[model samples]
Target: MANTPHVYVEWRGGTCRVKWWTGEYHENGRKRYESKGGFTDEDTALQHGQDKLYEIRHGINVTNRDGSTPMTQWLDTWIDSISVDHLTLVSYKSLIENHIRPFFKRKSVAEIDVMMFRAFSKKVRSVLKERSADNVIMVFSMVMDDAVKAELRKASPVERKSRRGKYERRVKEKKRPMAIEAVDQLARNTECHLGPSGSSLIWTMAMTGMRPAELYGLRREYCWPAWPASDPDREQREESAERYGADNSMPAIRVEHQVQYVNSKLTLLPPKYQSYRTLVIPDFLASMLARLLASHESDWVFPALEGGSMGSVNFDYRYWRPAADGAEAHDGPRVAKPRPALPAVPSYAGKRLYLLRHGHKEWNDEDGHSRVAVEARQGHELPGVEGVYSNVTPLMERRIMETLQARWIGLQQSRWEGAVKIDSQLFPTG
Candidate 1:
């Protein structure tokens, strides 16, 4: 036997054999060794042994030499390492189990070449929408990246050009903002169907532009008729007033949490992007909310019928759909014939409820509010150092509230005028 550090070459019967320590332990507490030989030349056999020794020293697992670990096995380990919100984890699991594992489970990590990935992407695109396919590709890329880090693969086969090229050409549908008249009509119809609290809830969403989850998370304690002086930041009110042209004493709503359904349970989680913001409301909306609050005895401003947080599914079905679709109140009838369909609200038909928030942003943009102020109000952080230093001044808040007030009054007047015509036909007052 001729020996190097962790490699050896032996000559037997006119053939040279190379062997190296693989640096792995067996279950019986013995070190593992791998050998390959059939070289007529002793130097070539010794060189092969030296290369294997280098691989072992650099932490490469010889057991995975053929990349035999299935993609599904690696994915299980990858998923277990993830630390995120439960709902987010659920989403990841869904993407992996439903989309990824089905296609790649039996394939080894090394088997996923660029061509194979492109084919997988095409298959995903065929089944899912563009945005959804993009999301799956993103998660797949992440898993492949982890495989590279774990030394399961030499490098990730996910190429940016292959993943983004086709999807990037797919134009994202622009969200159309609702007209003020439509918003008012939606509110009136909600009032007609679900009464005053429902009307107020829709109006609050329109005025504040809060995310649906954030709106659901609003509690009685967070809704204020006037800014709370006991707040830790109360001392900044004077400076904030002078800076942003805000009254500082005006009513505001604290938006620190959002309602999320995790593990089939309603959970109060931090706002999106972890952005906590306080929104000042118009005087008219403040009065409307005040009336709304008087109707609820629970901590949640918009509690479910049985109490606790209101689920979006329940709100959409029981309240929003009927209002948006229009409904009629019947006197009394046992007739079995299908009742005449209520008139479809043409302005709001096929529209999502979140468009109200988009409409609010449109109002802000039309009013020429600063980018930082708009983003902050919308609970988005400005990019770069600007977000760090630029704060929403009191004056900015005051102006925002004032502008919203004007829009609200204008919408109300338009709605009232529209209602009078319908009322005259229904009541026929001389």
Candidate 2:
């Protein structure tokens, strides 16, 4: 190659050095060169020049200048580069600033190696709870992983090391599903705390296994199962569905999107994992849903107390707390008398509405349905062979419907035997 590197004794100082041609001319048409010096002898300097020449010819530049990027600086770039909902972004930012940033301090990105990561993990555990520490570690790992992809580091140091000995086993409080009786009672109590309309939320969520956000985003048009054929607009709607290529099948709710607040404004986003599925529900749930729809002209199947989509804060503090733990006089906005509380569901004394979702899975399991159908109904994906070969059958869907209906009937009988009057409208067949 022309203008290649050569080792020589300097004319000015008689010192040994290597001058490498960069193969590029400046704007003024002068050759640009790079030099490495301070060698004690001619042979050493010549060897250095030869090695650099080979690297230049082969396009094998291994310089890692990106390692000089500081942890704090990279973090800012990483956070800005990530794409997520506003709520999730807020959570990641809070953890990065409050938990991760302080530990990393002013360290350069290169300094965070496997050993450094292990020491930081231990340090975080000492200050934070097990779960909190795990969350912080998870976010840090994600940050570092992105850095690796950005070529700021050669490799990621984060790993899920198996814990051993006394500190190894994580203490996980498993959520146990509520009994059919407990579910009915939770629903009845919810009726008292909120109103007749709000009670529908309990049964629908329990039977359908929809995520809370999915339920909140349920529009009037998406509910096919709940709409009976007898409605006056049924034919016109069916015609419209055919024209638009819609699935107007019964016993299903289309889970296309979820309502979430982004910057204090309600935004529609795809369901978790982008699992846009249609959940086939029991006939009992469909009937309950129909009644609910007839009662409200609002677009959402389950609207908030003040209108629009339900807020997590209001649903938790006002609805779930009062429904599970009972409400005192003057509780909630425009409240008056106290409401009687039911016995809290097993493992759900904290009033976690998510347990209803857990309970739905248990019921499906108890009914001896195939794992594929159960997973599909719950919007969860199976792994490996099962995910590939398994499919939900018609028989499985029918079984789910029959089991849920029988459970609702059993609850009615149990209530009747206990000298409690059954509402006629609740069970017209009875």
Candidate 3:
């Protein structure tokens, strides 16, 4: 990226010096230069200038502002410039602090190469499992790619597969999707612990495929359900539902934003990938939500048990884990009577909330519904022509509602261990 250099000789302070044009000029129209000094002789100084000219010409030593920076320093600079949501930004910073920075030490960014990265990868794999290491390495690769773009390195040291047949993908190990019956067990277990209200979050998430954050941030104004209300307000509820794109054919929940922690403070922001979407729910789910809402007075559709917004609270550990994995009764001198043991939902025993979303996808796949409709309902795009041309038909929406409602009815009929806990009524008896 440099141009031809002009070699020159000079003397200052009784010492020989060499100077050369660096293919740049100032705004004042004077050519900028790079120089070497204290050569102790004319020939030596002149030779130094000539050598620099060849180095610059061959692109071996073309002096520029973007020189090598320490790996840790470069990572800090790169992370600061990246645009990501606060939670994601926090995850990337953790990867850098725990894995990338410590291993690299004071090594310069330019010092890294494909071989060095491969070794670093092996180290990560040794410490962490294969999939987890891959996740950590992914963040590091993003930093290296930026370094290449900035001219700190000619190419990314992170070796990757060719973009063709048998292409490699990131290692993302997902838990098996929960079966519909198992989803019922998970919901019923929560019900057994905290009555019907506790189970609503479980059923809503499993059926609607709402992310935990989105569900936690759901507002009453956005979700208007009519069934199970002691006094129905059809006009007012429908008006509220219309604002978020609900209709007679398809009852929907609006996912406008999510609750998250930003700069150590709870905040509301757009959903992941900005996937602001309307998701259709079965009549049963809509009714169940109405019942849950009727019992609460907060603006949040789902408030914390302690009577406030569930903002950035670690619900997974305090609430979800106990319900999913089940807990043994604990009794000691500090307790009068031990609480009853929570029986684990076999399919969700070791899983998390994400698996419920996965379960939703599996249900759609099994129902033989339109791919485009399924993708749209799940807040995802199908990609290519399938995503652009295809649209969700009224028939597809009907089929979706029928299939989801069937699962709820099937649980009502099944004589499983947790079937007794399933709510006998959601929609009107009529």
Query: Pairs clashing in candidate 1?
Result: 244-394, 244-395, 244-396, 245-395, 246-394, 246-395
TM per prediction: 0.78, 0.76, 0.77
Name model 2 segments beyond 4 Å from true. Answer: 1-64, 84-88, 159-167, 224-250, 328-347, 419-430
Candidate 1: lDDT over CA atoms? 0.75
Q: How close is candidate 1 to the true structure, as a TM-score?
A: 0.78
In candidate 2, position 412 carries an lDDT of 71
The 10-residue segment of model 2 with minimum total lDDT is 421-430
Candidate 2's residue-wise lDDT over 1-430, tens digit each? 2223343334236656677665557899987666767877667776776776676677542233467788999889999999986557888999999978888887988778888898899998999998888889989989988887786776788977656646755576676556766666667767766565568788878887888888778777777543322224666547434432353333666777788877777788888777766566776777777787787787777776555666444676777766666544445656565554344443455658887888898898998989999999889899999899998765677678788888888877766765332221132221
Q: Per-residue error at 51 for model 2, in Å?
A: 10
lDDT of 3 at 65: 46
Best by TM-score: 1
By summed lDDT, the worst window of 10 consecutive residues in model 1 runs over 421-430
Per-residue lDDT over 1-430 for candidate 1, one digit per residue giving the tens place of the 0 to 100 score: 3577678887888897887778777899987777877899878898888877777678764344546788888889889998876657788999999999999977998779999998999999999988899899999999998887777777788978645334545585565455666666677767654566667778889888898888888877677643343234655545434443354356778786888887678889988767787788898988887777787687777766566776545787776787677666533467533333344455566667777888788889999998888988888888889978898777888899999889878756755654522311221112
Pitting candidate 1 against candidate 3, the one with the higher TM-score is 1
Top candidate when judged by lDDT against the true structure: 1
lDDT (0 to 1) per candidate? 0.75, 0.71, 0.74
Model 3 alpha-carbon drift over 4 Å, by segment: 1-20, 26-65, 162-177, 226-249, 329-339, 415-430
List the candidates ranked by lDDT, beginning with the highest: 1, 3, 2
Q: Give the per-residue lDDT of model 3 (tens digit) for 1-430.
A: 1222487777788897788887779999998888778888888788777776776777655353445588888988998899998778888989889999998877888878788899999999999987679889899899988887877776788978467788567657556555666676677667655456568878888887888888888877667553112113566456544543444346667677798877777788898878876667898988888788888787778777666556656777767788888888757789754555776665566677788887887898898988888788778888898788998766677788889999878766654433343223222111
